[model samples]
Target: MRIAFLLALLAGGVYYTYVAFIDLNFLTRTGRLGPGFFPRSVGVMIVLLTIWALVDALKEGREAATNAGLWRDVAMLMVLAIIYAVALRVFGGFVATVLYLAVTLSVLNRGRPLQNALLSILVPVAVYLLFDRVLNASMPPGLIDILPI
Candidate 1:
């Protein structure tokens, strides 16, 4: 199952990298980094890391059986991912991210409300500044605008 998962990721990364290179320019007219840069870089890294993990898994002996708790955690994350996708469509980028991070962190990183709260707000703000201000790219727009920021 682990090997299959890694293989799937490898295939996705290859396809992503192919599209990044073929459909998008690496540099703009003035030679600044283009929109493809981040996706291309991420795709490449994903490919490399997946390959490395696959190799390691192949070398290791039989996998230990997963417990019920492990399965529960995985299910929780899967549900959370679906919720996050819906939240993205409903609340847009910034607010959805903030909400997702808050809930996810509270659940996963228990007993650290202060840390989770700080991270919930800070990471999205940083990403917003980086994408909106520095990269001049727009975040996903939602159905209704709530926060002006």
Candidate 2:
């Protein structure tokens, strides 16, 4: 697990570095700090943190192997993220977010249906109101376009 985590982190660091440096147009006269500055900083931090974690895991002498079901959690989260992404495109941000939250909560909390439902519905609605109504941000128009707010 430690090895896998380290490798993943390293890969992400490299990818982000590329995005921040190679792909970013830093030559523009947009100021001292270009669009890539933050990404590059983040990439550097990721690399450093991964290295630290790797060292810490090695020092523990436990092989970083645990039956804590980390992979399952990671998979569930990934699935939820994908669902949210796709749903945002089709169902719009509000509906997609609610569905994603509900599904994620249901999957994670297998025995709690009522709590999951309430949370899924209420959380998204709250976020929608905060961003769309209060902050004047745009959200996806869901199937029920009547309430674009």
Candidate 3:
């Protein structure tokens, strides 16, 4: 499994490197550097690291990779992030942040619902105050503008 995973990673790195190479426009010159510079450099590095991983995995004895129990949590977190981004546009930063943090804390600390709820609300309010008052940075007045205060 480790070998297979490494091989897949290497294959993906190769494909990414190839795509980066093709996307690189050496003709369009920028003020400081060419457009292809960073992509080309990063792509090469990824390929090199992936190759090293593959070699290391191949050298190791074959063993079954244990399935980590946290994959579901990670997948849910990813979905939550997507939803949170959309929520920011619809509910505004404070409201959306409150919702996101509340849900995330609840998800993480299932046994301590009250604690999570308190922290969730408090954290967002603190962040809002810090940014809006101290920094004086303008936050997006998302749909409805529910949090005018």
Best by lDDT: 1
Candidate 2 has an lDDT of 0.80
- Supply every candidate's count of residue pairs whose N, Cα or C atoms clash at under 3 angstroms: 0, 0, 0
**TM-scores, all models, native as reference:** 0.56, 0.55, 0.62
The whole-model lDDT of each prediction reads 0.92, 0.80, 0.82
lDDT of 2 by residue, 1-149 (tens): 66787878888887888778887755458567677778888888888888888788777876745566887788769977987887787788877887888888888888999999999999988998898889998887766553444
Candidate 3 C-alpha lDDT tens digits along 54-115? 78777777866556767677888999999999998998888999899998888878999889
Model 1 residue 25 lDDT score = 87
1 or 3, greater by TM-score: 3
As a whole number from 0 to 100, the lDDT of residue 10 in candidate 3 is: 74
Ranking by TM-score: 3, 1, 2
Stretches off by above 4 angstroms in model 3 are 1-45, 58-67, 140-144
| Error in Å for residue 10 of model 1 | 20
- What tens-digit string does per-residue lDDT give for candidate 1 at 1-149? 78888899899999999999999888999999998999899989999999999999999956888798999999999999999899988889899999999999999999999999999999999999999999999988877678875
